[model samples]
Target chain A: MSHPAKHRPLIALVALFGLCLSVPAFAQFDAEAAENTFKDNDCHKCHHATKAKKGPALKKIAAKYKEKKLDEKEAIKHMTAGQKVKLDDGKEEDHKIIDTKDVKVQTNVARWMLSH
Target chain B: MDQRALILGFSMLAFGSAMAADPASIDWGKIPATKLTLFYPGQSSYEWLRSEGHKGASSETARGDSCVSCHDDAKEEQRQGAKILRGNHPLEPTTIAGKKNGHVDLSVQAAFDAKNAYLRYQWKTQNPFPGNEHQYLRFDGKEWKVYGFPKLDKVVQEGKQPGIYEDRMSIIIDDGKVPGFAKQGCWLTCHDGQRDMPKQFTKEEVAANALLTAIKKNDVRKYLPDTRTNPSDWKTGKSVEDIAKLKEAGAFVELIQWRAHRSHAVGMADDGYVLEWRLADAGKDMFSGNADSKTHQPKFMWDEKKVGYKSITADQLRKGDHFLIREQNAVPFDPNAGWKEGDMIPDYVTSREDAKGSAADNNAIANWKDGMWTVVVVRPLGLANSDDKALKAGGVYNVGFAVHDDNITTRGHFVSYVKTLGLGAKADIQAVKLP
Candidate 1:
């Protein structure tokens, strides 16, 4: 019998192209677009890279969810829509919402935040 | 003790004494500097943004997160910021109202010896013109009225708002007594119900409530969460009893202001604190009007016997400019004199007697040249006054800065976000050590 594995590269290429075409209609995570959303909202004004400012540090946020492996859908919703957050001082404030309407952008931001 | 050893000890003591006496004399060039590139945070005024065509444009940047992020060039950033402000206050955009649309990049240098901390700030002005001409109300041969209109107000109708005010720089300091300053910066103080803000309290409310009726001020000073409790619960919903408790707890932000003309005349800036625009200077708020309000007569004429009050010509009164009261001394406001339509009163003359000890606390020196104002303000560190936030060595503080220029007041000024300043220590926004 002809070795099926010999044609594996060709089969993989075709399958990848088909997958790309199928996913084109839905929002795919883009790192650059997520970064753009973060920048546009000036989220760094309070949330810093390493240390906490008015809000928690991005690294801490990433660490908090690293173990939980929370659903990405809920994370994106909270980031875009904002939620009440208790601060270090025991005081609470509505978390600042990212400034965008597109779901793709929101998804990208969520991915970027988790990656931090 | 050995004679040589005794002499050496005396010399060391003398050297320490000199450093303690003049901490302000530290050479700024030797000190490391922190350069801050501040951008105008856009229409900070809530009422202005809610208007038509102006909505949703508050954070709409041409590019980048903040103003300077995309508009890297200072000159270009200034112009673009001005364009935004003009779009908001359409009637008189640009320097006609003496408004600088954007943030001025500031270079701050800090030095601390054994006793005090000194900060020297240098920033370029939007325009070369020094805003020394403060409130100028001219006698229209009948009553003293505001000389002209500020750019913000509707034209033709003369508003009580003065067209001329001194250029000013202010610093709001928090030593952790004031809550939310670390998180929210100046916004904790700048909320509704304050003067010149939406839903401003009526005069009747102010008169009845001691908390509302603060110090005699043109507008309300900034408030913190501890004092202003009604709006939020992180110590929110503050009552009269709550305010008294806060005061007893010493929960208030310290405000230091340096005026170009008013306080500068006395060679000191005024120090005050806030509750609800309840501004009280650390010392006497000197420099009262010479003209009696009801009679409008010159209560105290310029003593021609001591120094003659000179008359300023119409030519000296440049068509679009003339608030130069600091330079001109005032004579009696003679209502019977031949007064023209554009004749202005001498800028309210400051009385030296009223400004003796009260004005000498916060010493300052200002020089305006080459289109920038370099002001060096010197205050002794660790003032143990009950009202003062005793700036300690190696301590960090949450600070907010504001600048008033271009003949406007209230919400019409440019502001900066929360910045941290450390004495003898370094933070993210560090005030580094002197050589």
Candidate 2:
């Protein structure tokens, strides 16, 4: 049999493509959605995606959640509004939002984290 | 009046050898923990979550340095959460009202007290930020009007205990003495439980007529009364007047919790605990009737209309989950103070060590100067071990001290705060470690 190793890269590409294709039917969501949310919301004010910046890092966040795929819905709930998050350290803060209506930026960021 | 005037009202103010505010300032052994009441940040609750909860997100990023970082800044931030409070109040369904029917039987009295009602009606306003609204409370039974709470806290403390339950949570109002709701009869239960049905005041009720009700109702109105400084109320902006003439109030509540341990160990014995939650952040920057993030003042209540804020629902507030109680060493009461406008206090987590669990030379990040009994911060590690299970984390603690004059009585009053992980999560807490 041909070495499966030679085709591994291609296999990964296919998986990535599949994820990109499965957009929700109701709303316009993409893997980069959360990234957009981050930008639009100016989350950089206190956060970064994969590192503990002003706030906790997004990567450490990924490690925290046991679920393989991040949930955009839940992240959005926490984003546009706010949610409770426990950093590696044992302090607590409420991640609430000022506005909830049309908070597309948050949704987009959630979409990005979901894909990553 | 300026602080100078107030200080002058009394003599040069000397406590012990140290020149101080008064004789009570000295730490002579211990004094009665008699009239201590916990003050919870009303903003740090469910009601606040719905309104202001969703803003300004943070995490315990420095391993275990989330709250301690900004709050325990004695050097700068004055992170005095623990020092100023009795202990931390955890969200045990048993403690909160309406959360669960829960554990006890004295609820009739407890219900009569309605935990955070005082704050909601008196201190909490529609807007909690941007000059944050400040108001007083006057309850007419049918409704709790937005109004200023009595600032007579010091007044009451200085005077007689007024035969009040100063050490616990609620305040009682005697029958036929209800403030706004005089019809409701005597008992005017304030922030703490001060009344119940059959337990009506006997001789005391007949003597004093004013229930710690609304300032207006309190004939003397010598206490903390509402001075109409509603900068936000678009329609009407009034000034201070008779306490009774103007009536306003709303709903807001918050609390502080405490957990005590026998030894410095994470998990120990049947240590008692207490929690003080705030009903509202009604006290605004008195300089400005509004609150600005840049210029934030920790006021406990405000009226929404005057502050241009829309009223918020408790359900909306609860959604933010403001109940994550922080544990700390309970600072004793020989002294009392808060993080000032431009002050800096180091985090005990990063600063000092408690005598019990700490390394001798003393090095964490901060340490409470062991000089006077003023409330100071300490640290305790929390954990549990059973079978092959072990859990541990850093818990900020507080211990307070009081001095009892030789004449005050020998029971030497004292209070030292310890951290408790509480009863529920003993199992999962084993492996956890605070950075």
Best by TM-score: 1
State residue A58's C-alpha deviation in candidate 1, in Å: 12
Per-residue lDDT tens digits of candidate 1, residues A64-113? 87678664576777776678877676866666676568776777777777
Task: DockQ each candidate and list the results.
Answer: 0.05, 0.10
Q: Report how closely model 1 matches the true complex, as a DockQ value.
A: 0.05
Which ranges in model 2 have alpha carbons more than 4 Å from their true place?
A1-57, A60-103, A111-116, B1-10, B13-40, B43-435
List candidate 1 segments past 4 Å from native. A1-38, A41-116, B1-26, B39-100, B114-116, B148-150, B154-162, B204-210, B213-221, B232-244, B297-341, B351-353, B356-360, B428-435
The CAPRI category of model 1 is incorrect
i-RMSD of all predictions:
8.5, 9.3
| lDDT by residue for model 2 (A1-116), tens | 56489898998999999987896522355644544345434454455555455466666554554365546566677675566655445656666462336656556566555443
Q: Highest lDDT among the candidates is held by which one?
A: 1
Q: Write the per-residue lDDT of candidate 1 for residues B318-347, one digit (tens) a residue.
A: 232222222233445555555555455544
How well is each residue in B87-188 modelled by candidate 2, as lDDT tens digits? 332211111111111111111000001111000001111112111112212222333333221122233334421111101111111111112222111001
Question: What TM-score fits each model?
Answer: 0.64, 0.21
Root mean square deviation (Cα) for candidate 2: 24.1
